[model samples]
Target: MGGDCESNVENIIEVKNLKKTYISRGHVTEALRGISFAVKKGEIFGILGVNGAGKSTTLNITIGLLTPSSGTVRIFGKNFFQHESELKNQMNIATAYADLAGNLTVYRNLKIYALMYNVPNYKKKIADLLESFGISHLADKWVGDLSAGEKTRVNLCKSLINDPELLLLDEPTASLDPSIASHVRRLILKLQKDRNMTVVFTSHNMPEVEEMCDRVALLHKGKVYMVDTPDSLVKIHTAPDLEEVFIRLAKGELEE
Candidate 1:
């Protein structure tokens, strides 16, 4: 009930009892403490948390980039770690944390990824993505030389080249200007509408979450403070917007 479970297998991402901890120089830090949530099909599920709220940790484990300290993360009903190739085929991750090969041109970068995924008609697919994002002009330029905004757009294109069933985005539009950010948001919403893609995105921008997500979970101190529809949560919490609720949760005003 907390996360719209029991709705249908229409649910694309299912996470249960997930936990992660870091031990650096014998100092134990619990990053994610028993987190649980699920994103249904065709929804832009938002995970809102401040810095070090374990958003990146949760994403890393879910995408199998980092081994979990404990618990499970499933994409499209299969565990990511157990079914690497298949889960990867079903999912794609995009974040600023990812490294782009400095030597590769944007076109080369995507071409390599497309080939890796064995995406059919790779050349045509690449063309389509470039045109979709209006990045064709930068195709031949080295990825390292691109502006941050261009690189961000390219990163999105890289994740989307395979047309994944589940897309993970972390602060996707963080560095872009307002107009570009708006365009990026619209593109994401369009992807959700047109492809019915299940998305789990972490963002600090409340209005963006309110506009893009059907549901959101506010995380703080390695715990999910609440999960609900933006409208419903706003009404129940008596807040004018998500930002206010985020403050309440982040400040430890909510119950554990």
Candidate 2:
């Protein structure tokens, strides 16, 4: 499924008949079974599914962290595999599971990534990012010594080091308290709007998905179960909210 074609919106990411299979110990697991979707530029697209439904597998493939068993991934209208390095330079990902160096100070950690990205005037970029995320005071502190919320802020700051056109976030607020999570959500929204950046994220929080996503793809048993806006899915499924839609999908109560 793809975004509105009538509007002629440009697709920043297009996944076509994507499939990924793993063979281990004479056992086979099909992580993705011909799932296809397109994410429009300048919009937040969410991938929602229960565990083992292939959410993470799909994201990893799109980010070039994993290869597909079959099918294709096209970023910016070009074959991703043909220009992975160049494409990756325009993308960055932030995840609590993908931690920064624990022994390094926040500033140092960011500097290392900035250097890797070959960011010009990296010091200024690092300083500006820390300030923007309200983590400037934590810059000198060791990443290992920071609180969970603080670390998340720093991770977000580092993600922006390259001024990426596309930002991928995996459970960006997974372990934070409500207040901190709310703050992080606001900051992400602000940055996405201010920069007009494309975002693809995976989150189990239905409310968060509904609040932030312009469109969502619901995966079930390694296939795209449905694709639509949260509100539209609710109405189309005759459900009360996105959470109910998710539940129905997970339980196989909804049909394609």
Candidate 3:
């Protein structure tokens, strides 16, 4: 059908047979074992997994930060490696593990990234982003002086400096309190809708994943266990919720 074909062509990111192996001190550790998935345009796709499940590895590869041992990543229907420079301009990531410069003021940090991305009217862009996150008052404050939640909000503001088409968020709400996390989630959804952005999200919070993701990929021990809507996965697995499904997958009780 024409509609089906159109939808397939709209996949903004296509990862094929992705694998990554790390060799440390003559010891080999497989971080990814041929995982593949596609993120459609204007949708929030979640990658769900426990620790060491290859979620971060997959994201690293997708962003061209890590070279895949044997795989192909296509973004905007072009080979990602071949067009990494151009592709990177259209993508940005926010992760708890990667922090902004601690010595810089919040505004200064965002300004540096905006210049890197060559964003126009960067001052206004930064101001609006900080305002949206309700942290405009922290602009003059040193990043090191901010609390964990405030720092997280600043990191998020930096990620949007480019107004990227593809946004990758890894454990985005990890350190925020319940109210702030909830507000962040709502803001993300609004941004995606307003900008028609394609988002790749990874979070350990099952309920949050269910609430935010349009679809989810469950990764277990470096392989994809399943991919489906959250409600559908729960129904198919006959589980009470995504948390239970995650538990079963992690414990290897749902192995195919």
Candidate 4:
């Protein structure tokens, strides 16, 4: 029971000069600084950055989980700060930081999340998502008892229970083994393809970014250093590939 996103899909998420700051002990930490971007429908947009590069800050702001100290974040051309209730239904996020209830079983976690979203056919939806992520057996297991990888998959499944139009993922495969990580990528691609979902993901995995993202934004020192396809960025920045681009960019060798 999903709405016709295409009929209303006009740039799912937009960030204009976004910035966030934290003040601790009178010291200002600028998390994001004047970042601007547009996330289009039916494409996997990746935010590539190292730790503390403002990628997490940006995602947090866009998902209505954090407020920007400056600038604007517009979803479906509507500001989440002004129209949160409507925006929350249109988007869903799966980040490790947004940890689910630990005392709940995997199935219970999914069930409650689906109910919270008011997803019709909630049970069937949960079942399908659980199967897709290969986490059906853990349905009855307590979330606190599952391994990190299992919890990650369960979190992913919970995100998909509602089949959101704009899905924001933060380091989705960061803790998985290589085989499971690839499987997770394949599953995410399949979901995007099947539902024409617009996705924005952040990751440090260069090859994974190359393999999954249609376009990528490299965040450096709290700002967007570059934005382009993997191949184009590599050609312009690093002759070989994304990994090279990452290394060169991080080293400040790939200017412009």
Candidate 5:
């Protein structure tokens, strides 16, 4: 939370006064309300909130999968809407529950994604990623043949195939055992440090957020309640840990 000055920091993602609303069969829902934030280069940012807290809506807008009702989203200083197709190449997204082609082998699925991203030397890159994630032995096996955790690792490797400048992950460690989850977290931190990558991910895992994220935004009811480092938030709330801080904020026990 306490890093370089905002003026000196290099921002990778700049979202200003973002708003989104959805209308379905006579019911209108305002998903986001004037949310504004920025993510700096080589930073791991976390988004935390309860269900219907507008976390997904904000992410969807940032990734260009959905349009905001108002405000702006800029990636690398260019408007996301105007430079979407070009900007997409510089960024990639991954989810823990990613559904890879069931019939395709891990290598084949990775090849397909690499082709889509127009990755150069894709074969070597894929091999490296598989080895880095400790899933190289499963490359020739069908996706359906792998266990749940194996598939998650494969999906994570796929996301990094392009060596994207930015990575958006949604629950990247969900459903994994504690050991594997810890390993994945370390891998992400290493990648961010080595590649100077900027990452924004949503997670309900408090300890993971505390351990991995450089800063965090707590959103509620379509608005960002606070943005700061996990440790700073815990200290400000005088809570013993981030989980307790989150609980206090989520339950409206803390006045924003």
Candidate 6:
């Protein structure tokens, strides 16, 4: 196996033989079954799978929010568990499920996170994010008053407040209108290129995955079925697009 080979020395993320099991109410659930993958630095990698396929489970493990029953997650050449605190300082996570303080104003909420991250020139940064996201008018508005789309923008802004080297996103555009979702996609691309940030995200939106991701991992029932570029997967599966590729994989029709 290519375990910890120098070939992966340049990778920003290296997960090998990862496994997670949960025991609940006298029942056992195996969320991951020895999945392995590596993400390169400055690359936008995607984790694609249907619900309960272990995409979220894998992401949670990568971000150190959950522990694995076996295997290793290495970030920047260091074991994740051993270097979690230090590494997390350079990483951030954003989800469509907003984690903001509902009672606080948008500005207040972002300000608190900015302070936590010790962002430089935070006021200017906050103003820029508000303007960029077209949420300047909502700055003083209570977060609870914002719409789903608006809250998503706010959550995105908070994720970037730290200017993290690595960013994790969970269904960022879920439930968003096409226009707003398009804007968010463009913004993410710009951020990735401008800052050379490493991004790993989970999405069921195949078109979005095809357009934005440099590489994708297809997971099914807690195992990675395949990992490749969108075009490559399409070519391999002889499908029109990623959606079809996913469908075939789900049906157990794709062969080695």
State each model's CA lDDT, in order.
0.84, 0.88, 0.91, 0.84, 0.87, 0.88
Report the alpha-carbon TM-score of model 5 versus the true structure.
0.93
Candidate 2 lands at a TM-score of: 0.94
The top-ranked prediction according to lDDT is 3
RMSD per model, one decimal: 1.6, 2.0, 3.0, 4.7, 2.4, 2.0
Tens digits of per-residue lDDT for model 4, 157-255: 877877799899999998899999999999999989999999999988889999999999888878888778888988876378898888876887755
Candidate 1 per-residue C-alpha lDDT over 1-256 given as tens digits, one digit per residue, 9 for 90 to 100: 2343442466777777778888999999999887888888898999988898888888888877888788777777777678977788767888977757879999899999998888999889988888888788998999999889899999999999999988999999887889989998998889889998889899988999999999888778777767888898888888898888888877877666
- Per-residue lDDT, model 5, residue 46, is 93
The 10 consecutive residues of candidate 1 with the worst lDDT sum are 1-10
Clashes of each: 0, 0, 0, 0, 0, 0
Off by over 4 Å in 5: 1-9
Model 4 clash number: 0
Task: Give the per-residue lDDT of model 3 (tens digit) for 1-256.
Answer: 0001122578998888888999999999999888878889998999998999999998888888899999788888888999999999999999998889899999999999999999999999999999999999999999999999999999999888999999999899999999999999999999999999999999999999999999999998888888888999999999999999999988999874
lDDT of 6 at 134: 84
RMSD after Cα superposition, model 1: 1.6
lDDT of 6: 0.88
Estimated TM-score for each candidate: 0.95, 0.94, 0.96, 0.94, 0.93, 0.94
* Candidate 2 runs further than 4 Å off: 1-9
TM-score of 6: 0.94
lDDT of 4: 0.84
Model 1 stretches astray by more than 4 angstroms? 1-8
Candidate 3's TM-score: 0.96
